[model samples]
Target: MKITSQNKLLLPVFCSAFLLSGCWLDSDDDKAVEPVELATSANVRVVHASPDAPTVDIIIGGTPISQKLDLDYQDATAWYAIAPNTYEISVEANLPGDDANVLTFSPALVGSQTYTILAIGSVGQGTLEALVVENTLTPVTAGNVRAQIVHAAPNAPEVDVYVTAPDTLLSAEQPLATLAYKGFTGQVEVPAGDYQIRITPAGSTTVVFDSGTLALAAGSDLLISATQNVVTGSSPVSLVVATGAGSATILDKDTPAEIRAVHAVADAPAVDIIANNALTLFDGAPFKGATSYIEVAAGDYLIDVAADADNSIVVIDDAAITLTAGMRYTAIANNTLALIDLDLIIDTPRKIATAAQVRIFHASQATPNVDIYVTADGEITDVSPAFSDVPYATGALAETGYVQLPAGDYVVTVTPTGTKTEAIETGVLSLAAGEIYTAFAVDGDMEGAAPQLILLDGFVVPQAN
Candidate 1:
């Protein structure tokens, strides 16, 4: 959606703030082509704050600003340049066929001013909107950093924010401010050093959101926004730090990781899934069925799967598994009975409100290389397969990373490498917006029938008590 420099009038001419150091420019040589006009321009940055929104395409005039990098959830851009005048702009959710226009802006830009344009709220809740905050351009004192804090989480409650030293007790500490949704603080310059940010319910000392130790380097300008937690974790919010260079998210230190396990050992019986050979993660889990995600503290552990609670009849024993904080994972007991193994897959869970993200896995030992097709109503008479020759999962989740599709009814079919004969065909599935689907092609029962598709929410067995 980006246009060339020759077509400036018909397309966008936005310049990155970092390349120009928050100045107005046209090319990427760190200088302005039209220095006279650049003196009266607005320094701007765009923030994608909508937790449930897909990757976006920002249209200014008629060109998209995403030719360089996509603007995804919890992402932001460096300072960019625009003329100090009113212009038409719109934010669109980049879907498969047609993009959905989620928000539009018509802010009048004053010359010699800085601004932040944010796309906020939930796309499914019909609250997707635009927020424009004019920043005061001023110099920071030497040995100090400028901080601007904003409350951007729509459903989060009003809370007291604290930026204090790490491990400081809240009993005697005073919060910097109490901010409701969409409220922001004026730029405050403070001595640059290490600090911790925490948020508590209004007028209470019960800490609900905690950001562990953070370092504020000297002479840095920071836009620290509290946003809805979508990248994992049980906390209601996470802090996004946007500086002149880029942005990063800070999750609560105690955030847990969720894991789901699938029973895909072809010839294995209903098995007892265990962890560390002691704790029972799943008792009598049948073939082709899967366990829902179990939230556990993020760490490393060992897993074992035995028949009927008997460790001696083990199919899998003491498999090493590691989980990270604020992330989701899937572990499948795949391969044939004689060669039973596990396939670990990293799960992506950022649900976009305007589309459905579908992930397909090849876990069947009976089925060879496959050609997968997600077609209209599962039709495959004259269409090409979306994935061709997808091999079996060999100790790792052989998958197609999340594919974005328009929200609607669709059928998923899996066929042998080049043939139209379906090994697995899912009926018309009504995939709604703001959701993620994980489908695995599994081997049939011990009797040996046609392979089938097993849709699971996630994968991985938890460590037992």
Candidate 2:
């Protein structure tokens, strides 16, 4: 299908290129011509715009034009050349046991033109569709830059965009363009300099998005897109600033920190974690239990552990902790109720492809400096301490850096440093490929409260292919 302009205007003519082994269609006279005599082809690229869709392969006329192409959200393929004709384009899942075509469409292409075939909308939600946009490569005026805005957010409403001087208020400015979902703006030229970009609902003064300050250089051609954000769970939508010739950057609306709470206090009762003495993060968390990581704006927070879910009875007083952006942390309630302390551990989430990462936390006040061993489930006698001389209190020897091990089921045993007798033995812990975990040595109250091993799940960092 032809890409119609927002104003319903026809596109102008541009230069053409070479054709391959397919039929050619002359748009000027509406006539089909032989492929042998035609020398013009179209410059086209495919984009994976569906946020939740799997990486896909592009097929044309039942031929696999792009194979095993794994395009995550917002990924685009390099330009390809094809003879101008009306051809059937299909998208198939790039996964095993599921080679079904997700979508198919026929679009009339013209010779010597440029087009972008975008797979938009959500997968399986019945909104999946492909959009064809013809691109104009006309050079911008000297000392000026060109840009176009694409609205690809599947769940977002129609919006109005503003590009103004840095820190300009959206309420005081007019939108440069108003666009609907999947709609795009025509290439607009602007003076190359620093400017801020904002997006809001159509005809509303409330600002829903903002790009602080961006430096658009002279002669640069940019494609700024609003898309679903898979990272930074704090925001549903984010901006991706891509150039026609270079790399792209995700302008996250807000940087967030991932944090979890752990109850490691041996003798203390279940508690609730309160932040800023007002918000209850966790309720009735039992001893040795760990909560799943939660995302929050990066900053310093006054943290406290209360005896009640309502945070009415205070146990551990306000403890100030600063969490950095894009980092993972665990706030452990350690020591005894008499001491009532907290320890913050920065957990590294980077993933290793061939092995699992394991770290040890010494939370048991009853256990002395110990040596830890990890071996195949039944081969505890064959392996040595992965970590040695780990102390009891929250100090230099209280925790160990992550150590990598082959993925499998393993038996972990803790012993007084230099001894072979196991002070505590974890029955059997399974470490999966590319996973990260923390093993906490908790109070095994021999007198009815047994000392035990607790495992806390950690984040797995994505690996580059």
Candidate 3:
């Protein structure tokens, strides 16, 4: 079926001529008005049916719009319209018990006013048209990625899909270009680097998209296509992961130098540093170019070298040292061995009372100040609601006193005040009426380090009637 997009431009043109006193009036008297109206362009739609299928929401620009008609049968009417021009369309359907399918389309629409109806059953999957107005294929350079929707199934099921950074799981901040297409195929242009290709389809919780990594180089085009998605739970959703091509890597950081020579004891493994995964082994190399350093839990580690040579040497802050939490260290290497500098710190968790004496510990390292807010659900046997404050300072941990709050989902946020240059991090801690929970905030800034959260199980004293 066909749908017509209203022409917003013509209404103003006709009104302007009427006010001008006969510009369009002369033409109107010379010719008869056309009874049949034609569409300037058309938008494609998808008809999907699955008990667990999600409801799709279309977006024009950044505004939320309606869903495509769910034509479960071939004869069901389903279609969309576009006003001849370039547009960015996004389709998303995220709901509980429904598979998540978010896709987009970037097509140049024409002004001929016609219906470009696409049969739904033939292409089982939905179709997203990048309507080319003048029959011209827009030249997409390397390092640029574009999504294309190819509904290959006539009566096939619908799946979920999204374009994001490989391994990182989130979309890249400075992506070359992002547009929507129908199928799982997409093109991304990037400088030479190692990157993971992520594609998540409907019905899957985690990133069931693609697992293969990308090693993109300058002026190179990469194609990604997914066959299926990773299935989870008891539902039958089509989950497909994208596939990667060529030698493209998402370059995050330089490889750490070898630590074998400096290690008087154990050798270090070939270090692969993942973003936000926490601290890793020290290779005894200077961390001069790294954007951020890793923070490992307080412990001992074995260091090794990426490569070893004769009489090679490495330098570090110290020969061997035990480290704690919330610290930064550097590494340096020469010929054969790499040296590492270890920075250690201890972030403490706050203590709170459950009932009367039970306590739970939480890390507030990357938090600024912890605020305790309360709500009561009528389960407490006592009413001791006093609090203490502990302030965090430079080179020292800030301690805030504590306060008692009634049970419920209490929002605890660390609001930094006074010469403090940090953003607040908020959390919801559910206290079981009489149960106790100790929570605090650390520093979200790099200098302050991310806050630590600890939970110590506690119980409340039973009340006597």
Candidate 4:
């Protein structure tokens, strides 16, 4: 349950007792031998590679190493200096209403060595385990950089990796390495410059992953691990490049961006969404409705929304929206008919094992400013509002990203900025673990009425009080 860390100091004592003859040696024979000193310290880094594991809190020797609700899949911690000894490391899942201890390991660390401790495999399949690889920290030759590859993706098969000049043809080159799941290659040196990385099945020429162009600078030592792509994109694996200072992600160049449309404009009739005036992206979308995510090429397009009854009555005309690769976006139509506008949000739909992420969006043009509360047991008499003076939705994720919540049931209420009289209330929300809940507050169905809630992302709220 706890790790024991200790640093023992050993000082050697030498006795220079040499006499001219053997007579003086007898006086020193009673002295005891000096104790030997062992090497004192080691270095290690922890990585969360288990594709299905929850956000984790790592504890060693009763001390928490990872902050609560912070470390998750595809994340790595900085190197830590630890004394050379055996320590118990515990990984606890941040599940709601219970203690969830996922894995525990006691590793005997050696002095002066460096290690990467990885949590891998699937948690649901009961194959979760730990892998520790000793990293080589020796400096490389001049004008070259040292790199290593680690295969941490559970879903991928044996693969052939190519690291060559940009625009190099795959068929004419030999693979730099072949790796299976959890496999790795020894550290190798390459000339520092721009290069392209591609991966394919061991015996096939079909590429499954591609890093269009990457730079390897001189004097840099890197460890790149192939991991499950849980964040976004079509590729199954993303490369996590770890350096001495920190880590970075390398997404596939072929990954497409995603967009979801939301109909939040109250008093507006059902409409059809068009892209570049050519494609009808969402047809007959009613008020308070939202469309599912759709994939498209990452580029710029002029968006238009016209009446479902007649396409000539365009609600939104020629609104330019730029979509970037490897990102997910939400386009919401809000405000009144005369002042209608678009709110483009870069969505981050993250799933962690320990907690759920709730996105509270304000699209109600009726309320200029309101106080929002997410409370346990629907009680807010003595608690401060979670978000105060929240205006109607605007650009940049509406400038309010997902809020971290421990997995459990709760209530959500909204009222005018300074008063406690609720304009809308969620009776009780049975929120689940690792789920994302989006509750958009919109104008009431009728004029001069209180605001109402529109649920999205499959989260349902009970009737308001």
Candidate 5:
């Protein structure tokens, strides 16, 4: 009787029976019993594809397979080997005072196969999911390599991918493949060499993403992916390349910064905020009004607030502002025209799962030192100040540290210290879970112009002002 690969399952049972029987065998009989080969182990690699999800730790079978793995946006992990078996995979967000798994999956891996488990979709939008792909790692022709591309960018549209030489102009080149969200391409063979990758809209010449340069070794198998770029404010798509042997690398493309303009000066007229005194960034912003967040390339600009969009009659002149990548900023045309100035505040909001983060900014030069009260709406008279004795100009910009509060409707009031008799700026604000907020007290002399609270939904634009 011959033992083939299909009959290999019975070999374990046959060996167990032979072990139980204490039969004395000759040395020649022992030589006749050949060793049975078992199935090869499987290879698995993890990719963090969630755009806004924080750094995560990958856990397998109740134990952490990757510890403190800082897989930021578009990051991938090297491949790991495991015996062909079922596994309980879990992904936990590396947040303070939290060890809860954000996602979990149970998969049974097969022998001599490769698998990629990806964490995809948005975390706050409740669309997060884990996607598994069975990878093909068969060797290609000599001096050539096999590569595939996976599109995992949840917010991106159908895109064309281009692999070319370094410094190649995208407008003059053709795409290698066109893929939609969650789409995967079959393995394509190419000569092993140095190459660059670019992504553009389908049938368009505009390049949306670029991977400077990468080297592909001969006989290597590669898996490239398009993922969400969280660092960029507009959530542009980025890329991650993984080898068949499990090594992964992220090729980040330049993304725009986020910014919004706020007309906080009560006495100033309606104006247009211009970048570099030429390009109109915010048009026709009225007093106490704020524009929606706009995306721009990360760089320095001379921001000028003009009375009109024609760049004539500048109200706030030549305010130098530097915009950094992956950051959110608010340019406020604050104070009266006599004391007209620009206040640039860097807004970095950290959202908790169950609560909202609130911060206070004192932008009103006329308002005296006051206490800030954040209490349940209609309960301001019964509660004390949340932030007490907050001075109007403490060194640089008067701002309070973030305070986490339960998500609900709350009333914010600005009053003189030790007395809540006359609230200068009082307004009702509704805070939602997993969001951050900033309340700015604006306007000069209560007698000249009534003080009001300009509420900013912190990281984005103002929901209401």
Candidate 6:
């Protein structure tokens, strides 16, 4: 929020000028006027260090008041002044071959007063003074231009508003401005001009504005609001402009239809459900949770309900289901058909107390079987009290596999039993109580493994109970 002298007095003067100022004249000449006590002090000096000759940026209050000064190293120090009121002063100096110096100081100045500032070694010192001067400019056209705040996504976190304007609108040096507050509440102030606005959501690829263009005149303002499709409720975006002509536009988008899709596992291969066919739905697209129904122009879809990635007892539970405009559909997974619930569990032979369970899947059928052997008490034996045969130990295996381990450390060797003679080793595995880890062997050599490890230790284990 920048408050300039002209802005504070514009309204009254403009009204008077239009209403004929000559009509208002003081008729009482005998009244005495007491002197008003001055509230501000003056001259403050600031000096900063410049070991090697370098330039410094001087700012008073929130405005840049001076040009960069180049001072010689070992004798590098500069000074600037501001009015004696409490000031927020900032100095930025750069020394070649050394780190830059940025400092802030708040000092109160009285009328016709001076203050000296000394920042040596790295930063130099300076002085400041406030002078008693008569006012010159009258207010009629004082105003500010500000950036509009917008949300990147509906119901999502607010985004930072930005502006890219023609160089003519801004002084060549002051091309950008930063708003003070965070999210929707913050905005930047500028003199009125045509600007390009960009709203970026926090950690997102979606930008609120399709094209960044905004225009404002003196004493006017423009507010920009952005909303998303997934969001249901209402969210408003706002911005504050001190000066200029203004307008506000809310960036809005329609909400997409919410469609719940249930796979009819029992009807797989029997009923031709349009949505159950794989071709109808986009491949590799995330459709978890409720079936995300997008607004369509009106059409039929063939969905492939064939066994999904999750190998439940029933694979491709239902066939194709017809989809229509403004209509809802559900595919059910019944108890009849064996929906392949690829229920998988892996176990190690013994608790090594140092290594973790290492599950292996045959990268290729030609690869060796994934045999997990156990050596209890450091002895390789046919049978032992501490070691037991893992339930899912198979001579050969396919791609996806899961592993379950008790809380401990163990060394579980992963050897491709059918294809590769070489065994790939894993790092030490530390499992907290009931942790389920899944390993995937995509299209790769038996040696290549991109295993996903999910820690389910936070949940209770039914086996133990």
Per lDDT, the best of the predicted structures is: 1
Q: How close is candidate 5 to the true structure, as a TM-score?
A: 0.61
**Which ranges in model 2 have alpha carbons more than 4 Å from their true place?**
1-41, 60-68, 245-249, 261-288, 296-465
Best by TM-score: 1
Residue 298 lDDT, candidate 3, scale 0-100: 34
Q: Which stretches of candidate 1 lie over 4 Å from their true place?
A: 1-41, 66-68, 276-279, 458-465
Backbone clash numbers for all candidates listed? 5, 8, 101, 4, 1, 105
What order do you get sorting by TM-score, best first? 1, 4, 5, 2, 6, 3
**lDDT tens string, model 5, 376-413?**
76456778777777765523447786676667787777
Candidate 2, backbone clash total: 8
TM-score of each: 0.85, 0.54, 0.19, 0.80, 0.61, 0.20
| Positional deviation of residue 164's Cα in model 5 after best superposition, in angstroms | 1.3
lDDT by residue (1-465, candidate 6, tens digit) is: 000111111211111111112222211222211112233435433332222213455567877644334332111122233455777766655432332435677766556433333332222122212111121112213455334342322233544444556322222223132232222333445665455544445434344533223444443322333322212212232221211111112222221212333221222333222353333442222211113333332233333333334323234434333332213222222222342221112221121221133344332222233544332222223423221222221222232333334456544344444322324334455554323332322222212432211122222121110
Q: Write the per-residue lDDT of candidate 4 for residues 7-60, one digit (tens) a residue.
A: 212111111111001111111212311111223457667788887777777777
Per-residue accuracy of model 3 over 1-465 as CA lDDT, tens digit each = 011111112211111111112222112211212112234444333332221223345555565534333222111122344556666755454332342334566655565432222222211133322222121222334443322333223223454444344455353333222222233333333333444433233444344333234332333222222212111111222211111111111111111111111111112222222112233343322211111233343334433233223113322322343332212232222111232222222221212112112222222333333332232432212322222233333333333323333344543332233322223323444554333333323222234444433222242121110
RMSD of 4: 15.3
User: Which ranges of candidate 3 are over 4 A from the true structure?
Assistant: 1-37, 49-53, 67-78, 97-101, 113-151, 154-465
Candidate 2 lDDT by residue in tens digits, 1-465 = 001011111111111111011212223221211112133776566777776666678887677655226554566655566788988888885432346688888888788666677788876466888877786435556667677888888888889889898878777788989988889988898876767777888899677766555656666555667886654444456665444322243444355777787887767778998899787777788776778778887777888888854556777777887765546677778777777777777776544333577888787887778888877764556567878888876442277777766667888888889888788887777787557777788886443455687776643322111
* Pairs that collide, model 5: 79-246
Which lDDT values do the candidates have, in the order given? 0.73, 0.66, 0.29, 0.72, 0.67, 0.31
lDDT (tens digit, per residue) of candidate 1 on 219-247: 66778788899756678997766665556
